[model samples]
Target: MTEEPVPVTRAVDFGTAKLLPDVDRARAWLLTVDDAPQSYVDLDDPEHLEFEYTRRIAHVLESAFDTPVHAVHLGGGALTLPRRLALTRPGSRQWVVEADRGLAALVAEHLPLSDPDITVHTTDARAWLAAAPDASADVIVADVFHGSRVPAHLTSVEFLREAVRVLRPGGVYVANIADGAPFAFLGSQLGTVRAGFGQSADLCLLAEPGVLRGRRFGNAVLAAARRPLPLDALARSCAGDAFPARVVTGTALAALTRAPVHDATATASPVPPDGAFTVG
Candidate 1:
């Protein structure tokens, strides 16, 4: 496949593997999920490399936690965020949980994550979070996905509770999710996330309400912290420039009051009462 004449936008090699992209200038990406390899089309514009999103993530996280952070990935991609974190904060320790065995095997083939303060583990994200001890992680990134869908179990209410359970004090949870126009899953996800993290649920949508209402294309980063998240500082620190495309949060934060928490043990949860969040 390496000899097939695919454009190589960037390439590298890690301690145990060769890092390369299947194509450059736009191609396809097969993400390994809990089940199998799912496909996505890369517009091939440097603009769409999840790196843009990852960069913003790096910026917010670095500013949020001044020192190097102990990070955990519920899903692993080209390991872009982990790699960038390693470069920006040397000596950080990261654990990436990837479900696809073949995809895990191909890490060194397409990208190298091991050397960059990351340990790749093959497993389901929820199970890992559930079985782990109390407050074991400082920050948990639940960006697990294959194509546009998340594994069925991963989105369930029970799963998110465990995600929150494994986070340490002031630990934050970040999840990358996709939804259809009209944001078919947005409300319910907000509902479920509210149930999981109480008033700490904060959203960073790749698209805005009008766009999400159209539901044609959507991707968002939903973040929750054991403590209050710094949405305003993040907004200010962004220097009034949106990441990737135009995005504004000052108004949205008003509409995103924290939903009430369902019992941590319950599978299906109900949205909690108002006043759960201290609206910004």
Candidate 2:
């Protein structure tokens, strides 16, 4: 087991994050969490990012709505996806909720998500989720995390209920989860979201199913709405230049909401194999 993290207070540009090195470590982040200063904690791993999968999310959401959708981000990691959305669909309203006050400042300067349109909120992600400008946003993203797990409070059944409350009629809820090694955290989280969203489809790495590539779990962009959102066309259409991959929906979405992880064999099929299988 790795030693507990040493407190970090010094400020340094952590490459992609642009936030202080201390901020990362305190919350058990890459620059700060567990043991070594592994690159995955430093934003070196593109695969673990919301941006890597945002375009696909955007592609699907765009199809769901006739116009640009209102969006919010719970955890501000370099604001990659937010930046992408603002760029792809100009004049869009976005709110980014960051827990770490300093992280907001760091991303304000460094991360690529500096659109004058996006409003950055510095507060507990859950509070902001409830207090956010009411039924104004069309999408609500809750991707906040501490090391691998979302702070337990955030994942509690009650909190998810709150998330369902704030979302628009067909709003999309996206979550980025980290499940690796000997834990079923990923699958369980998937179950939690599935229970909440009612509709979800995974956006995982382009690899074979059940393959635990060490720290390489997968992303579950779970989307749900009080009313069904138009997702098929979104999944079929190619996202413009800025975004890549088609939006996945139907079985794909269901898979994300109810993704299965094979525990009996210790190796299972892809959580949401729809997108991958359809393409293959």
Candidate 3:
């Protein structure tokens, strides 16, 4: 009989990091920091994305980009998406910037990525992006968080501008945001992305119906690009997920707007209530 994997815990720079094994899937693990679920990875099945938001992000990439891509990921939690990208898009070059050095090291030692194409940097996401050459990436994925909240610095128009500079023309920028109905932060972020990219960029949001309707605190995946997004394909992909989600754009997106956030006004995303996203 196969041995059951045990949980491993370590004190990282940001918080206590834990790796909890999936009882049903021997090679699968869920990475959590301070009780908030971070990333779920099935080492034996890179195509399997356990988180709804992760699937939504993957849908955007799968729908929009057919060939290999030069991708930059702001958060590197167990390198889940990087592994998926390596499997789905062979020859793709990926760069992952994770701020928590100790957490990065813990993941590296425990998870042990096999893809040589993916390079992990132990540094702040914003600083790394600011230094990146213009038009250096085909896609940028922003999913960084300190514990449960997205850092204030990463939520501003300035940050989006840096993203725009790094992305090649027509490249996509996708972010995983957490909020509920009356999505002030989410709206502001959308506005910031649009304002940063100007009038030419197209944007959309993918989220569950109830979450969009103010049912609960949850994740929302937002996508933007200089070119038109594959909304039809994205809608279908999101709807077919185990927990169905809807894509909002055009008028729906326009209605959910807020003044663009600047560096001076930015703040970390709102904290969740007790028991929210507590790992079982």
Which candidate ranks first by TM-score, i.e. highest? 3
Index of the highest-lDDT prediction: 3
**Model 2 bad stretches (over 4 Å):** 1-51, 111-114, 180-183, 197-216, 237-280
Write candidate 3's Cα lDDT for 121-215 as tens digits.
99999999999999999999999999999999999999999999999988999999998778999989989999999977899999999899998
Query: How many clashing pairs does model 2 include?
Result: 4
Error of 1 at 37 (Å): 11
Candidate 3 at 162: error in angstroms? 0.3
Candidate 1, residues 95-198, lDDT tens digits: the string is: 98877665566654544334746888888887777788888778888776543356567766677788878887888777665554444355566666767776
Per-model TM-score, in order, reads 0.69, 0.60, 0.98
**lDDT score of residue 23 within candidate 1:** 54
> Candidate 1's error at 54, in angstroms?
2.9
Worst 10 residues of 2 by lDDT: 32-41
Candidate ranking (TM-score, best to worst): 3, 1, 2
Error in Å for residue 18 of model 3: 0.4
